[model samples]
Target: MNAATQYAISWKGLKNGTYHFDFKVDKALFQEFESTEIEDGDLNVSVTAERTEKELSLHVAIRGTVTVACDRCLEPYQQPVAFDGDLLIRFSDEEQEYDGEVLWLAPGETEASLAQYIYESIVLALPYQRVHPDGGCDPDMLSRFRIVSEEEFEAIEQEAEARHAQPLDNESLSRLTALRQRLEEEDGESEEKN
Candidate 1:
């Protein structure tokens, strides 16, 4: 089902009273909104609503984990999510924008949609530095991004100048030496046979 219809609460049939709703959040909701930060998640959205003659007050709580890319290693990791906020829905005939705290719905509308609110709340709740726990990053990826000291960079630059080309690493240098030795041995053997 579309996220718009799935997360909506119908209130036209009810008299003034309090109501509760439980919703499960999965990949579909994020996919519907084309969320780039949140790749996937398993979350619960609990909403409690108090309806009166004028407006509906909603208390929203969300808790679970979402998959996101780690800033350090660039690998996907699970990040915990928790958000608690309140929203008020008021009936109006004129068009009004949702200001994160209040929602304006026409009196003729039967359902109050919570899809955009829920998605926005999750995005805002994410941490600025999204990453996995210490020592949990991929070693290989971390090594690729290792910081080079000034001395190491200077040595590399000098070596490059001496070689008049890009400096070769230890492994590459050893392989080149072994290949040269093998070629010399083959040349010696052929000369002896001749």
Candidate 2:
């Protein structure tokens, strides 16, 4: 078969037994997959394939470091990932079905490639929200965030104060005070009513 097929397992040669394989995935391998999340990094993958008369089972363990952009500052940084999972490759007459951690393949199929499994393990290992620790971020980036936060806080406080200091004539003030008294009386009444 072609390179991609070769990287994937061929079901024809598989025997009804367990097999162990180790692979080192580098930048070139990621390029082959066109994976943007992991542009450059060396990943260690240990896979175990067990075949029975009825179906096949695969277990994959992956550990590596990948360079990814920081969500906060948009700067590139290294992130370590570790993953361990199992896959059940059952024979099906219909099309493949992949649910969460399980896979269904054609019963007639012989070999299954580990490439897709490795890629998925790496993807799953990534954090949902990636950010550097509080003080671990870049100085300039942290300062910028701090300044923006302070400015926003000041603006909000000013808006609240301005709202509180609205100009009111004596008549309006008296009406407002009367309204306030009415509200207080209503609250007191409710408290007693309750």
Candidate 3:
């Protein structure tokens, strides 16, 4: 089968039974998808798709190591990642929003590939703000960051204390308290809205 065909599976092929499939992702797969974030690595995926009369369930277990540039130093390093997730596929005549763990695929569709999902899972597993653990970083970079962070922290604390020390009347203090309450309310509202 062609690459596109290999990527998607037909729903008829997965009726009322459990099936296993595996794919090995290497440099070629990345190249095909034009993914520059991962230039070198190997990924293994074990997928179990089971159909129970009406609903289709897919469970995917992923394991792999990808080479990525260290955030502290521009040097390349390998990061290992593992993840498991389930997708539910419900046969539907019309496109519908599904809130469950499963993804819905239209009936008669052939071959489903989890390459993109696996890649995204691995990427999400990485730290949002990656910094080498304390002494584990490059000496020069760590030293510079330490000095900058300390200076910034001190400056911020001093500014906060200075603001808090300013004298105020009872009326002014009441207004300040009200303003603080309003700000806290706004913060909570924003979080809920998000």
Candidate 4:
């Protein structure tokens, strides 16, 4: 069976009520979609499907950890992921997408696969900047970037801050103030004309 087939839900003969399905999502499932951001993960996905007369609503809850490359160290590390989402499937004569949060099913459709939705929820739950906590990163990689003493580092930071905080000369400040006044006057004149 294909990857999507495993996640398909058949509503052909079922009555309108609530249903539950659980799946263990791993690297294989992600790779099926050619996902490159995440290489592997161990997550439990719980899907709750509630069918009513007008629509079918699905609640997706994903919780577990996934391995991602560190932005600074470039080493793979496990990152915890927790996400919750809702999908609304509406019946229509022809398949049509109302928006990102809603999907349309044809009148004769029998199955709906949730593999793509599950993948997107997991990926979106990850942090944009993937990095280990302080002192958790590889020491060897950090040493290559900065090996200075604590006092030396503090001194360098203070020096940089002082440079940024220095005030401009009086001549330059006066020139800037005059330029600002001129711009404001020009703006007022243009507004009056309009």
What does each candidate score in C-alpha RMSD?
14.9, 12.8, 9.2, 11.1
Off by over 4 Å in 2: 1-3, 144-194
Q: Which has the better TM-score: candidate 2, or candidate 3?
A: 2
All candidates: TM-score: 0.75, 0.63, 0.59, 0.72
Which ranges of candidate 3 are over 4 A from the true structure?
1-11, 96-101, 129-194
The lDDT values for all models are 0.84, 0.68, 0.62, 0.78
TM-score of 1: 0.75
The Cα error of candidate 3 at residue 94, in Å, is: 1.5
Tell me the deviation in Å of residue 123 in model 1.
Answer: 0.5
Q: Comparing 3 and 4 by lDDT, which wins?
A: 4
Pick the winner on TM-score between candidates 1 and 2: 1
What ranking emerges by lDDT with the best candidate at the front? 1, 4, 2, 3
At residue 190, give the lDDT of candidate 4: 45
lDDT of 3 by residue, 1-194 (tens): 43344445456645588888787656665566676666677778787888788876888787887776666554566667687888777777777755545555666554444555655666666654444445455668545643233344455446555777675556755755565565566456546644
User: Which digits, one per residue and each the tens of the lDDT, describe model 4 over residues 1-194?
Assistant: 66688878787776899999898888888789888889999999998989999888999899999999876566789999999999987789965765657767787889877778888889889987787765567778756754333344456445545667676556655755565565566456546644
Task: Tell me the tens digit of each residue's lDDT in model 1 across 4-109.
Answer: 9999999887789999999989999999999988999999999999999999999999999899998767899999999999999999999998999999998799
lDDT of 3 at 101: 57
For candidate 4, what is the TM-score?
0.72
Candidate 1 residue 100 Cα shift, in angstroms, is 0.8
Which candidate number would show the highest lDDT if scored against the true structure? 1
